[model samples]
Each structure stands twice: as structure tokens, then as C-alpha cells.
Target: MTLFVAGLSHKNAPVELREQLAVEEDKLRELLSDVSATGAVRETLILSTCNRVEVYGVAEAPGEARAVVFRHLCRYRGVAYGSVEPLLYTHLDGDAVHHAFRVAASLDSMMIGEPQILGQVKDAFGLAQACATVGPALHTLFTAAFAVAKKVRTETEIARHAVSVSFAAVELARKIFAGLGGKAVLLVGAGKMGELAARHLVEHGAFPVYVANRTWPRAQEMARALSGAAVPFAELETALAGVDIVITSTGATEPIVTLAMVQRVMHGRRARPLFFIDIAVPRDVEGSVNTLADVYCYNVDDLKQVVEANIRERLREAQRGEALVMREVAKFLTRQSDVEVIPTIVSLRERLEEIRVGEVRKALARLPGATAETREAIEALSAAIVNKILHAPITKLRESSRAGSSRSWLPLIHELFGLGRK
Candidate 1:
């Protein structure tokens, strides 16, 4: 199958277009199932974040998979096909694999080396798995991409500084509280970024965690996973009063926590310092909440400065990460090229073996004086000779397949061996 990727990202499209194409967590399974049903795509995964909307898939043809994906995106977004075509970007086979690796490594992030995309990619794969849209090919490709990302993170200093929304939240909490240990962290919603931030806090020794969500079951699920307590959405004010830090990532169309709500909570705690991180796209906490005394509220845009600064400090490491991606792309390309020639080589080998066996059998019947044991010995010798003659050519064909130059040698091999005439 031919691998292909098509979509738009922060680098190629504005936030408006990206947001328009973004798929919600609840919608992912259905979207993937629909895309996979198109028959043009064999396996599919959709990665939809605030900064990008990418569809990765394998198909029988290169351009055909991309066309199918593009059409689906246009249909989902209600954008005219003609209007959306100009904004979409398509990558085929090797380039598609390279893009997936780079994205997982955060090399193509708005802030280079940011770590959030890795988790986002994982979530996408999970959804695809649940929808039965991912088979062995995609499973292998995604697992390898994750491995490469881990290698880049551990072997290089790409993540030396916090450069993602989630990491930035951790950094801000650190600056405000002097230390994360023994701090009370309240996660307002269980969105992906908020969950990631909560994990980071827990890693850094934050204790007595509390999670509140619109859905009590989801909140309880996250709480149980993190070994924390779950509070009802109605008790958000009470939960806020007890926590030293708050991270919000709800998907509300409007602000969930207002200035008045936070101010009311501050009264119960005697205005103790509280770090509020608003990582949601539409923003959960109101802008006015930042003005409250002893309340430090930071929005997504404000965090970008810290993320950008961290990216600047890791430029050297990022160069090394880029080199790794290039090497991986080369290796993936070689394998993909080899896949194309495998069937042809197998067919040719079978043809040759059939001819050799047929000739040996015909000659044995003509030898009337030959005994059974003699005929069997002659047949074995002919088989050995045929194997010895073809070994070098077979090995060379396999090697040529991997180098992506099989087309150049295929015609000559076919003519010399008369592979198909029989």
C-alpha cells in the first residue's frame, strides 16, 4: 500500500482555518470510520489539534488517498471543495512518514521541541484503534514514530526547557509557588492538555489533587487514574478555595470561571496566592480574573512567550533532531520501495522453478535404461544446480529493490530469464 498524509497546520494555515477543521474527541471515531469506509484508504488516523488537522492513511495509490482525505475534510467543515483545496497540503509515502515523525518529535510544532504533540498523536492512535481503522501497517508506523520521539527526547536536549502549553503551565506553577511539592492542584476540566499538566504536576511532587468536570464520570475516571479525588462541577468554587494551583482546559464556547466566581473563592482562603493556568483554546478563565489580588491568571497567548524563549535556547539540539528525522525518512523510503518489488520478484522466482522442474521430469521419462534410484539422484542434482544458478541474481534483485532502483533492473532481469513467456 502507498502511504499518504494531507491536511493543514499552523505553518501553512491560519488559526481560523485550523479551528474550522479541528475534530473534537467525541467526533474522532466516527470521522475515522467514515474516512476508512471510502475504500480508497486502507488504514486511517486523524490528528486534530488547535494548531493542525492531519489525516494519515495507507492506500493502493498515492494521490488517491490524499484526494479521499481532502474531500472528507471539506465535507466535514462545510467548506466548498474548490475553496479548501488551496489551503490543504499533501505529502506522499516517504514524505508522509517523515511528517509523522517530525510532528511526534515536535520538530514541526509552533514552538520547536514542544512535547504536547506526542501525547496528542498517541490519543489519535488510540481513537483510530478503537474505531478499527488502524491495522498492522499503521500500527507499526505509529509505534516507530513514538519510539523515534522518545529517542529524540532522551538522547538529545530538545526538551531541556518547557516549550508546550502543558509544560508552560508547570513552569508558571513552579515560578509562583517556588516548588510544586506539597501544593494542592485543582484541574478544572479533563481535556488532554489539562490531563497532561496534571501529570507533570504530579511528577514534580504536587499532592492532594482534585479534578472537576462537567461530566462527573469523566472527572472520577481521571481522578482515579491520577490517584486523586473528584469533585462535582457545582462544587468548583469550593474546590478552587482549597487548591494552591488551578489548571483549566474545558471546551466551553464561553468562559467557565469568571472574575466574580474566583473572587468569591478568594474570600474563603484570605487571598492566598493562587496560580491559574488557562490553556483552553476558547479560554476557560475570564481575562478579568487576572486582575484579582494574589491571583495569577495566564492565558494561552501569554504562555507562548515562555514557550518561544525555551525553543530559542534549544536550537542546537533541534538541529540534531532534524538530522535524525532525515535519517529515519531515508530508511522508511528504502523499505517502502522494497515493498513494491516483492510481489514481482516472488512471481518471477516461482515461474523459473516451475520451468526447471518440468524440464527435469520430461527428460527423466525419455531415459528408459535409468533405474529409479539413478533418476531420483539426477533430479536432486538438477534442483541443486538450479538453486545455485539463481542465488546471486535473487540476492541482487532484493538489494536493488531496497535502493529504490528496482525499475531499472526489472526489465533486464525479465528479458534475460524469460520469466513470463512460459
Candidate 2:
């Protein structure tokens, strides 16, 4: 069987296209079943994330399996094939294995070396197994991918720096304060990005965290999760005055933290430095807030600079990770090649045994006076001859696999032995 991967990623498609194809777990289950029901692939797994949507499958024909995956992605998401065809990419056999290992190691992330993608991959694998779409092929591939990821984490420094926007924000805060110990932090929006930054801040010893959102319940929920206090939306200005760091990532189109709002809060703090990290798309903090003395403001664009530099360092480390993953991929493929030849070996052994049994039976019939002892001797002699005849061919077949010449000899072996194709 052929192993393959087909999909689009952040490298080939825009966010709008990626978002259109993103699947929730429930939908992903249905999609996995749908793809397998088409009978084009023997095993399948789908990995969907904010940055990519890919299907990994095993089939007798790689081309047909890849085509089926592409068609399914377009049909399931209500997207036109024409729109997606240009952006889609396919990797077959060894290339597919390499891609899977790189992805699991977070080397394929939009922000390389980020940790979230590994967990996302695991979740996808688990969901596919639950849907019964995963079989031996995918099971082997995913489990090896997980091992490669673990090796990358332990062997390289790729994930040691902050490469994400949220983590970069924390790095910036730490730089400004020399350290975040005993500093108060306020999450202005309680969105995913803000929550991640707050988490990092807490990790760095920031205490008495406060979460404020437009919806009171969400604020409370996030506050509870972070082990902090929930502040009312109206009390945002008061929270601002109390905290030394503010991370905002709301869905608002307009600025929520205005110059005047921060200006009012700064007066009560007696020149205490407050850092605002605005990770929102439309700019959560007014740009003019940076004009105020002892107050620092950074938007997403500003953080990208930090992310860029961190990414450069990560790239240096990722080289080492890539080498490790490639080594693991080679080992996995060698094991798979050895496995691929087992059916042929079994067929060969059975064919020899069939001939030996028939010959021994015919000999015993010819000698009506043969005693039980003589018959047993004949049976033993025939079995030894069969084993001797089969030994060299079986050993050669295995050696061919290690030498990467199995494809050259496998078909010949089947034809010569009159064995049906596996």
C-alpha cells in the first residue's frame, strides 16, 4: 500500500481559506467516516487546525487516495474545488512520512517551534481512532510521529524561546520589569490570546491576576481558570490603575483603552510604569497612549518584531530538530519496509510446506508395508528438505528490504513462486 498526505496549509492558503475548511471534533468525525466510506483509502486521519487542514491516508494507489481527500475537503466544507485546487499539495510515501514528522515536531507551524500544534495533532489522531478511521498504517505513522516530536523537544532548543505573539508579549513585559515577580496583571478582554499571555505572566510570577470582559460570566469563567479575580467591564479603568501589565485581545472594532482612559488611571499610580500589550486586530489600545510618560504600549505589529527575532533563533535550533526528525523517519520507513515483506515470506513458507506434505503422502501410499516409524522418518525428512529449500530465498527477501531493493524482487518472487499478489 502507498502512504500519502494531501491538504493545504498556511504556507499555501490565506487565513480565510484555512478558516473555511477548519473542522470541529464532531464534524471531523463525520468527515473521517465520509472519506473512508468512499472506499478509496484503507486508512485515514484528518488534522485540522487554524493554520492547516490535511488528510493522511494509506491506499493501494496514492493518486486515487489523494484525489479522494481533496474532493472530500471541498465537498465537506462547501468550497469549490477550483478555489482549493491551486493551494492544495500532496506528498507520497517517504515524503509524506517526512512531512508528518516535521508537523508533529512543530517545525511546520506558522510560528515555528510553538507547542500547541503537537497537542492538536494528538487530538486529531485520537479522534480519528475513535471514528474507526485509523488502522495499522495510520497507527504506526502517528505513534512514530509522536515519538519524533518528543525527541525534537528533548534534543533541541527550538521551543526554548518565545515565538508566538502572546509569549512575545510576556517576554517584553519581563524585559521591561527586569522580572515579573509580584507584579499585578490585568487581562482586559479575556480572549484566547489575552488568556495565554496572562498564563505566561502568571508563570513568570505575576500575581493577583484580574480578568475583565464585556460578558460578566466569561470574565468570571476565565478568572476562575486563571485563579484570579474577575473585574466588571465598568471597572476596567480602575483595574488598569491597579495592575502593572494589561493584555487586551477583544473582538472590538474600535479602541477600548483610549488615551484619556489610561491618562486618568496613570494619575492615581504616581508614575508607576504600566505596559499595555494590545494583541487585538483593530488595535485595542489607542496608539496615542504611548505619548504618556512612564507608560509603554505595544500592538501586534510591534510584537511581530520580537516574534521575528525569536523566530530567527528558533530557526537555528529547528535545523537540529530537522536532522533528528529525518533520522527517525528513516528508521520508521526501514521498519515498515521490513513489515511489508512479511506476507511474501509467509506465502513462500506455506507454498513449500504444501508441496512437502503432498510428496510425503504420495510416498507413504506407494509403500503399503511401511511401518509408523518409517512414515514418521519420511515426514521428518520431507520437512527438513522443505525448510532447506525455503531458507535461502526467505533470507534474501529480507536482505533485499534492508538494501531498499524489495520493489525489484517482490514481484519476481511472487511470479516465480506462483503465489497470488498480496
Candidate 3:
């Protein structure tokens, strides 16, 4: 099977399109299983993040795999097939490998060098494996992709700056308070992005996190996981008064935290400085919250600008990361090609062994007084000789398969051996 990747990212599609295609966590397993069942794909993994929804697979036919993925995406998003077709992009074989490596390394993220994509990629792989949609080919590909990401992270300065919305939120908080230690942080929603940002805050030594969500159980669960406390949604004002940082990422259709409510909370807190990070797409916190004194409010767009500026600053390091990804992609492609070469090499060896055994039998049949033991010894010696003669060539062929120019030598070996004809 050949490797293939087809989908659209923030670079290729707008946010409206991406949001339409975004797969919820609950639907991921079913979707991956259904896509893999299409029979065109041998193995499949779907990565659905806020910025991109990509399907990576190994398939007998690249076009068929692409078509299957495209149809599924269109159906899931409830979009006309023709409307979505123009935004889709497809990559095959080496290009697919390159794309996977680049994505894992954060080179293809909307915010370059963002670390969240690595985790998202890992989650996708895990889900695919759990659903049995990931087999040998996809497992190897994803593992290699992760290894490439780690190499780029450690060897290059690509991740030197915080280039994600969550990290940018933390950066803004740091600018406001100068230090996060001993500061209480209130997370208004239990969304993945909010949890990530809260985790970052805790990692930076923020203390006594208070989580509030529409669902108390989820809020309590997240609080327990983070070693924090759960506060009811009704007690948000009280929670807001006690916290130095407020991060909101709810999916509310309207503003959850309005200017009037924040102003009242400010009064209760004696006008203590509050850092409000609205990381939600629809914006949980009101825009006018920034007008209040001692209140620093940042929205998604503000964080996006921060991410953009940081990306520009890290362009030089990103180039180094890109070079590393290229090297890894080449390595992975060489290994995959070698997988294809092994069966051919084994078939050729078996053919040579058959010829040697047949020739030895014929020669031994004509020998007078050739006892059973003598005949067996002759056959063994002939087999040994054949093995010794072919050993170096077979070793060289395997070694050459790892080099970029291995294709050039394949036809030569086939010609020299004349092994294809019956």
C-alpha cells in the first residue's frame, strides 16, 4: 500500500470551513472506523483540530482513498460535495510522508512551532489504534512522525517562543502580573484549549485553580485531574473575585461574561488587577471588558497577532526545522521503499536455492555408489556453496535499498539475475 494524505488546513481553508469539518472527540472513533471500512484504505488516522482536519492513510489506490475521505468529510460537514472539493488538497507517497513530518514538527500549523499539534496528532493516533483502523503501515508512519517532531524540537530552535493561543494567553498573563506563582487562576470552561492553558498556568506555579463549567461533573472532573477545586457556574462571580487570572473558552452562542458582570466582580474585589483571556472562538468574555480599569482583556484575535509576531521572529529557526523534517522524510521514505524490496529479495533467493537443489540432484543421480548419506552430504554442500556465493550480493542489495538511488539499481539486479522468467 502507498501512503496518502488529503485534507484542508487553516492555510488552505477559512475558519468557517474548518469549523464545519472539525470532528468532535465523541465522533472520532466511529468516523475513523467508518473511513477505514471503505476498503480503499488499508490503514487510516484522522486528525481534527480547530485549524485543520486531515486524513492520513495507506491505500491500494491513492485516488480511491482521496475520494473516500473527501466524501466522508463532505457528509460530516453537511456541505455540498462540489463546494468542499475546491478547498481540498492531496499528497501521495513521499509527499504524504513529508506532510506528516511537517505537521508533527509544527511547521504546518497556523501558528508555527505551536506544540499543541503534537498532542493532537498523538491523540488521533491513539484513537485510530483503539478503533483498529491503524495497522502496521500507519503505526510506523505515525511513530516516525513523532520521532521527527521530537528531533526537530530538541535539535532546532523552532519552539523557542510560545506561538499558540494558549501559550500566548500565558504570555499575556505574565506581562500583567510579572509572576504567576501564588496567583489564583479561574478557568471558566472545561474545554480542551482552556484546560491546556490552565495546565500551563499551573505548570508556571499558579496556585489553587478554580474550575467552573455548565456541567458540574465535567468541571469537577477537570478540577480533580488538575489538582484544583470545582466551583459551580452560579458562583462564577465569587470565583472571579478571588482569582488573579480568568480564562474563558466556553461554546456559548452569546457572551457568558458580560461587562456589567465583570464590573460588579471588580467592585467586590476592591479593583484588584484581573487578567481575562478569552480564547473561545465565539468569545466568552464581552469585548467591552477591556474598558474597565485594572482589567487586562485579551481575545482570540489578540492572541493570533501574538502568535503571528512570534512566528516571524522564529522564521530562521523554522528554516532549520524544515531542513530537519526533510531529512527525516527522506529517511522514512527510504525505509518504506526497503519494505517493498525485501519480498523481491526473498523471492530471488528462493529461486536461486531451487536451481541449486535441482542441479545437485541431477549430478548426484549419475554418480555410482552414491549412498543416501553421501547424496545428502552433496546436497548440503551445494546449498552451502550457493549461500556463500550469494551472501555478499544479497547484503549489498539490502544496503543499497536504503540509499536514495536504490531505484536505479533495482532493474540492474533484475537484469543480471534473469529471475523473472519461468
User: Which candidate number maximizes lDDT?
Assistant: 2
Quality of model 3 by C-alpha lDDT: 0.86
Candidate 2's residue-wise lDDT over 1-422, tens digit each? 88899899999899999999898998888888988999999999999999999989998887787777777777888989889888889898889999999999999998778899999999999999999989998999999999999899988989877867888888888778979999999998877888888999999999989999999999999999999999999988888988999989999999999999989999999999999999899999999999999899999999998888888889999999999988998899889988989999998998888888888889999999999999999999999888888888888998899887898899989999999864
Cand. 1 Cα-lDDT? 0.85
- Give each model a TM-score: 0.57, 0.63, 0.58
Better of 2 and 3 by TM-score: 2
Off by over 4 Å in 3: 163-310, 346-388, 391-422
User: 1-422, model 3: which lDDT tens digit per residue?
Assistant: 67889888999898998888888877887777778777888889899999988899888898788778778877877888787778888898789989999999999987677789999999999988889999898898889999999999898878876777898888778888879999999998899989999999999999989999999999999999899999999988878889999989999889888899999989977878999988887999999989999998889899899978777777888899998888888878778878866766887788798999789879987897899899889988998898898887777777787764557666777778877842
How large an RMSD does model 1 have? Answer: 11.1
- Tell me, by TM-score, which candidate is best: 2
lDDT over C-alpha atoms for residue 118 of model 3? 99
Q: What residue pairs are clashing in model 2? A: none
lDDT of 1 by residue, 261-332 (tens): 988988888868988888898999998988889999988898888787777778879899999888987876
